[model samples]
Target: MEAALDAGADMVGLMFFPKSPRHVSLSQACKLADMARGKAEIVAVTVNMDLDGLSRINELVAPDTFQFHGSESPEACAAVKVMQGTKIMKAVAVSEKADLEEAQYYAIVADRILFDAKPPQGSDLPGGNGVSFDWTLLKDLDLKKPYMLSGGLNVANVAEAIRLSGARAVDVSSAVERERGVKDNDLIRAFIAAAKNA
Candidate 1:
């Protein structure tokens, strides 16, 4: 993360999904978040969450943004915004035109949208698979709120992804990890460097 920051990443993310090997306990996640806070923005990624869960996370990590990566309805998202009083970033898996429509619903409510690749059929998780959708899917999109481009992004492909999608900000979890969930400092640094220079 220090390397990524030095490489010019504007934000860093910590995943809190149990099904994902990248899941971080509140305490463990807190240390990582605290490390990145003020150095670069820290984003706490969660699935559908309850109020208590959010409160616990907020108390521990104090992230600058909450990245919701579940099937939470727009109304639920609104509730999250009200309860947490933190910027909300909603992730939508896009594999088709309908997905873009879905992105609109969250646009009105969320502070930002994360365009990610759709999880495979029967998959319990919605994102963090490192799947990259076609950047052209977002080419014509012009919105009131800024968005993050994600999915299948890595040092080798992120520059093109940013250019094709017109994304100024991006997110990655699996791409920087050495294993399923453990992050690699060198890859993280390279990714940040690659993204900034792109």
Candidate 2:
């Protein structure tokens, strides 16, 4: 979290899904959220958590945005926005052009959309699989809502990924890690620099 903030990240995501390797405890999230409060937009990334769980996270982290990375319906997303009064970002898993269509359903309820690679079959995790979809599938995307590109982004390919997909924002995970769940500061800096330069 500190590394990304120091690297001038516009937003920082704190995972709250236990199944994900990147998940953080409530206390850890609180500290990280506090650290990023004024420096960058703090996003709380969750799966299909219930309202009670969401409330707990909101009370502790007070994130500026809640990113839903699960099978949350448009109504569910709207409910969260109304109940929490925080911006919403809905992640759509893209494998083909047809998958991009899902973003339209969320456009009305979500403040932004995040296009991520579809999770591999048999994988328990929903994202951070180091898999990237065909970027050209988004060459003519028009969701109206601001959208971000994510999935398999690294310093080596981020610039091209941004160019190919015409993405104004992006997200990275495994690429900046020394190991599965551990982030490396230098890689974080390098990736941010590369993306910014692009």
Candidate 3:
């Protein structure tokens, strides 16, 4: 978290999904959130979690945003926004042009939209798989709300990804890690510099 903040990240994500290697406990999330609260937006990332679970997180973490990376409908996203009074960033997995259609629906309910690569087959996790889709698919995207590009971004290719997708914002995960689930500060800094320079 400190590395990202030092690297001038606009947001920092705390994973709440148990199945994900990146998952953090409520206590851990609280500490990280505290560290990043004022410096950067604290985003609580979850899969198809229930409201009760989300409420518990909200009460403890007080995240600035809730990033829903699941099969949540627009109504579900809207409900969470009203319930928590926090911004929502809904992830839309894209493997093809047809996948982008879902972002249009989420745009109405979510404060921001995130375009991520679809999880590989047999993968239990929703994202953070180090997989990438066709960035060109988003070149012509037009939406009322702001959107972010994510999935497979790294120090080596983030600039190209941004240029090709025309993404104003981007998110990274496994690419900045030294190993699965472990973040490397140097990689984080390098990736941020690359993205910013792009």
Candidate 4:
């Protein structure tokens, strides 16, 4: 986290989904969040957590934003936003152009939208699958709410991905990992530098 901060990362995400390799418990999230609190925005990433669960996470993690990375509806996102008084980012699964339509509903309630590749069939996780959609698919998106592009971004291809998608911001996970669920400081630094320079 410190490495990413020093590399000029704007936000640091801590996952809460048990199924995800990157999942962090409440206690772990608290510690990580505190460390990154002043340096960068802390985001609590969850997958279809209920209101009670979200409230508990907000109290413990104290995140600046809640990223819903699942099949959560706009109403669900709105509820969390009103309940936590924190910003919400809804992750929309994109496999094709029609998939982008999901963002329209989330946009009405979410503060930001994250476009990620749809999980492959039979996959247990919703995101962080290390897959990417066609960047050209997002070339003409002109939504009212700001959006971030994610899914298979890396230091080598992020700039071109940004160029083709016209994305102002991007998210990376597997690309920065030395092994599954293990982040590499060098990769983090390189990715941040590449993104900022791009």
In the range 25-50, model 1's lDDT, one tens digit per residue, is 88888888877878888888899878
* lDDT string, candidate 4, 1-198, tens digits: 879888999999999999989999888888889889899989899998888999999887889999999889899899889989999999999989999988998999998999999988898999998899999888989789999999989999999999999999999999999999999999999999999888
TM-score attained by model 2: 0.99
Select the stronger candidate by TM-score from 2 and 4. Answer: 2
Best lDDT among the predictions, by candidate number: 3
Preferred candidate (lDDT higher): 1 or 4? 4
Q: What is the clash count of model 4?
A: 0
User: Which of candidates 1 and 4 is the stronger one according to TM-score?
Assistant: 4
lDDT of 3 by residue, 58-141 (tens): 999999999999999999999999989999999999999999988899999999999999999999988999899999998978
Compared with the true structure, all predictions reach lDDT values of 0.86, 0.94, 0.95, 0.92
What are the runs in model 3 whose C-alpha is more than 4 Å off?
none
RMSD of 4: 0.8
| Residue clash pairs of candidate 3 | none
Model 3 steric clash total: 0
Q: By TM-score, how accurate is candidate 1? A: 0.94
